[model samples]
Target: MERRTDRVMPPRYLASVNKVIVGLHRLGVPLPMQALTVPGRKSGVLRSTPVTPYEVDGRRYVVAGYAKSDWAKNARAAGRGELTRGRHRERVRLVALPVEERGRILREFPARVPRGVTMFLKAGTVANASPEAFAAAADRCAVFRIEPLD
Candidate 1:
């Protein structure tokens, strides 16, 4: 398979799919997906994107398959966002995980969110979808710990 750079914009079809997923999530569908809404770093307008949360022990995390994606940059600047799934919504603080601390969490990503592995592979974030591959790509991928706010 050919490798694609992360700097490449996501395919146009993904925008349509994201709209559908976000729409479904807003309608209270009980899917394993959530809509993450955060302010754009420069635009300041709120942006929503579908994300799969990965849990390890008691902690929840969201990973950016493309490290430099807009959402990742926005989340880093905004520091907080809203996580919504079905009818449930909660404010969350997204703390970026250091590269050194990302390996263990990424090692479980393939098993915990197998469906998401394809994005990483297609984006050239990892060589393969194996746990080891994800782990090895820690520095290239962005990870955020999800902390709930009262």
Candidate 2:
């Protein structure tokens, strides 16, 4: 598989990560999954990404580390998406949270960090720091909460 290594780390990485997590989930280990798919704000192409999800009160969300990235911009333009995990898929609407809510979610992320995620976290790939530092870094990301359509 050709992996993307751009300094900006485009949406392709998200898809790669999803393949790994979905594989793991299929093996009976459930990891939080977030999919970011949007119609191009300008070009009209459909772009999608898989992300590590943060959950609250049965709802799922994703933190966009690079807020200005194309995925984020596309999401803002599309406003809605399809989120899938295992056999469960739902139509969802995206909502940007207030900074206070984002901070709270970030602070609570360590509890959800998967056990096998230490290597990546420790290597500074994904908020690999003390909980406080991780939260701080997460705060810099664009936080979006998803509302599933019943």
Model number with the top lDDT = 1
Model 1 lDDT tens row, 1-150: 534453644555787998999999888996788999999999999999999988999999999877788999999999999999999999999999999999999999999998988777766777787888889888778899999996
Candidate 1: TM-score?
Answer: 0.90
User: Local error of candidate 2 at 92, Å?
Assistant: 0.3
Model 1 clash pairs are none
| Candidate 2 residue-wise lDDT, 1-150, digit = tens | 212222334344555775676566455454456445668989988666666676777887776655566777777777777665655667888787766677666655667745424533433435454556545554345678888767
Instruction: Give me the runs in candidate 2 sitting further than 4 Å from their true place.
Output: 1-34, 115-128
RMSD of each: 2.1, 6.6
Q: What are the runs in model 1 whose C-alpha is more than 4 Å off?
A: 1-9
- Candidate 2, residue 2: CA error in Å? 33
